[model samples]
Target: MTDAPLSGLPLPGLPLPGPLLPGPLVDDAWLAARLDDPRLVVLDATALLPSPGHDGDYSSGSGHAQWAERHIPGSRHADLTGELSDHEAPYHFAVPAPEALAAALQRLGVRDGSEVVAYDSGGGIWAARLWWMLRAISVPAAVLDGGLQAWEAAGRPVLGEQEEPAPAAAGPLTPVPLPHAWAALPDVDAVLRGERPGTLVCALPESGFDGSAPTRYSRRGHIPGSLNLPGRGLLDEAGRFLPRAELAARVGAVLDDAASPVVLYCGGGISAAGAALALTLLGRDDVTLYDGSLEEWSADPARPLVQQG
Candidate 1:
């Protein structure tokens, strides 16, 4: 890739990119104002894997622990790796079939035009996964910027318990389906080919950009011609996104030279969602993620892998 300056297109001050359907993202301030609106649906996305932390704290296990105790009023739990995912897959949290996804959303009371908001304790990475899934299904959705941390910082109310309403009965929201929505996915073949420019973005840390694998990927290198603007580069110490001005400056700096057709992918497509979140904030409408990411790419014995320092 070539070095470039900050981009000035689509204006610099917008909240998110342009291709993102409406409700790409909404901040705590915005959600706080509309928290009680019946049209709005909030989701809790905090998750902890079965693994324990140094302090013995479970990571992906936190969502249920927190949600069962207290959550934003009217918010439901959105499990990216759980209810919304498939464990019987080649990979975990592989996007569910459109029919299955729509059914899942309908259970949460999401209908045509239902305003959906998702947030995780993490800086909206997992949340954006859900947001992206919703987009795939053509559902209007947004992530809670800064996630629950921002909610707490704003002193917003959280609920420990709430009435569990009867699960609703509904079907897929969209009548039109993806040409391969159920089975279609970004594969190693296409990525190794590097068919699209600017769309194939890498959120890997610049410090380790020699194409070192970041644990999740099966191989030690990244796909060829990938963009480098690590998602972690977009965060502050508290695990929240940087201020809009700084975020724009950094994102614009990266995109200034980037060609177009933005496609983002990280170790496992997690952190890249953070960059996608940032791009959406910038108002760029063209963006897609290589879902299989390096994990799928590196695992392929036939695909080519490129490294940069």
Candidate 2:
């Protein structure tokens, strides 16, 4: 893995001009300095996951109430469960059509040239999900490295309901979809059948990946032939991404020459986005997210899954 930071130069697989942020991952200090920039749009893309034993749907909950209670200043809440997702899809948190996504983002004041920074109240998974979505549309966006926890740990001030800003006025955001950024069921099946060349990465926890933990899906374990890289292991105690050296040490061997395009998936595609963000930060732009992930994969009984020893 290269220690070099993502520069202004166009990324390898992503065909675009350049990113608005310095990199795909930004620290709280970096954001604090640009809070007042008119071109900047800060988003609180907080979505709560169901606890292991809970009976809630994977993408059932929103963090709007939590955001109303407290959030970063000047940040607007982006609804991942509702407007930002494809409600018509069979699985939860499915990526919406480009035009639908563009309209939803426009309602949140994302103009064509706007630079966005997304952060979640929990681990960076939800925020990364939004970042991945923005990337699919070729929008210039980045994730808040440590999320709300890190922001508060650094003594950054947060806004309460009383101090919240008014609803963002709509802006003109045209979607330029990058189809290659996503991997569909057929694509994954091809990889499983050995007809395609790619790496299948599962971002779930060890137990979830190995079928030891209870799951909401029709089956447990992971897609056959997947390599495990738990999303939680990608972060430090404070929920920030590990330093580049540490991150490289953890994922380098698994990814080193494994394949050209790395296909990532998790329970409902949320945690996989976190992995995707980590790989992007590591300068591996040849990453594609499985939008349906386990939710779609495990639903079909004909599809196979395997448990790790």
Candidate 3:
């Protein structure tokens, strides 16, 4: 939105084709039916969340290698690490500026009127990050239910090429910031200082939250008083989000009110989107992601962290 493409006309084309699905999580059946909508664009927003041994390894050439192996036929890839994230930022996967985001999206063949469906091989974490970014800019987008694994499991055909879509025509992409949807470093500081009213929820696994597992950040443990709700808890074995009632129940056990103000964070802010997306599906639109997350917080010795023995 900050970076609006110069032209208002639609770009000439894409190899695959939409209007998006009605909900945030579209299924194999739903996507398979409408693969030819001109206004529809499918993006494989796949990126491996960094592990202790693989921290900051996107530069080593493995990210693109995995993408080239298999993906939805005719789908374009959105690189969360290299092209899409804010490389200038100190953190590894910081969200790009509105201008940067708008430009990258245009290159990926997203028009002002395009409906986007994002999916990833790492469940939906990477996909949800893209979806959340679009939502932050007030753009309409959705995540594929269960991602590529589900599609493959259902015997769907896959394309091995890792090609990008034709550049879309320029359009007025006014990024309307959704205030409630994003929580930055300052917000987390405010929470730590007791000037903000909200719950801090770490969407990382229990080991990550408890500082018992290998970490990729500058420090171990979590923000003081944060609860552990591993992102996997929000999804089933097939990697699709859980049913609404069940989802609400699992999350509600921690924060009962659907309207409760909660700030979600995980390492580098990726898994946080998974939690944010799950909360969105449960009709809890009050949640936000700490953009810098632990990557920013832990690096500063002045910021307090809580660790378990």
TM-score, every prediction: 0.77, 0.91, 0.88
lDDT of 2 by residue, 1-309 (tens): 112333343568987654448878888888887787666899999987766673223436888988988899999999998899998999989989999998898888888878899999889999999999999998899999889998998999998884446545566898998867999999999998889999899999998899887787778889988999988889999899998899998998677757878999999999999999999888988899999999899888889999763
lDDT-wise, the better of 2 and 3 is 2
Models, CA RMSD each: 8.8, 5.2, 6.2
lDDT of 3: 0.79
- TM-score attained by model 2: 0.91
The TM-score, computed over Cα atoms with residue i paired to residue i, of candidate 1 is: 0.77
lDDT for each residue of candidate 1 in 1-309, tens digit (9 for 90 to 100): 111222223556775333222457666777776665545667777665442223223234336766767677778887776667755656655666677777777887776646678888766678877777776676667887778888888898877774644433343466235332221234434543665334456786874345432344445556676668889788887667688789999988878777666777765566777787788777876777767666556666677767653
Which residue ranges in model 3 land beyond 4 Å of their true spot? 1-19, 53-62, 165-172, 257-259
The lDDT for every candidate, in the order shown, is: 0.65, 0.86, 0.79
Comparing 1 and 2 by lDDT, which wins?
A: 2
Whole-model alpha-carbon lDDT for candidate 2: 0.86
lDDT of 2 at 264: 96
Flag regions of model 2 displaced more than 4 Å. 1-20, 54-59, 162-164, 167-169
Top candidate (lDDT):
2
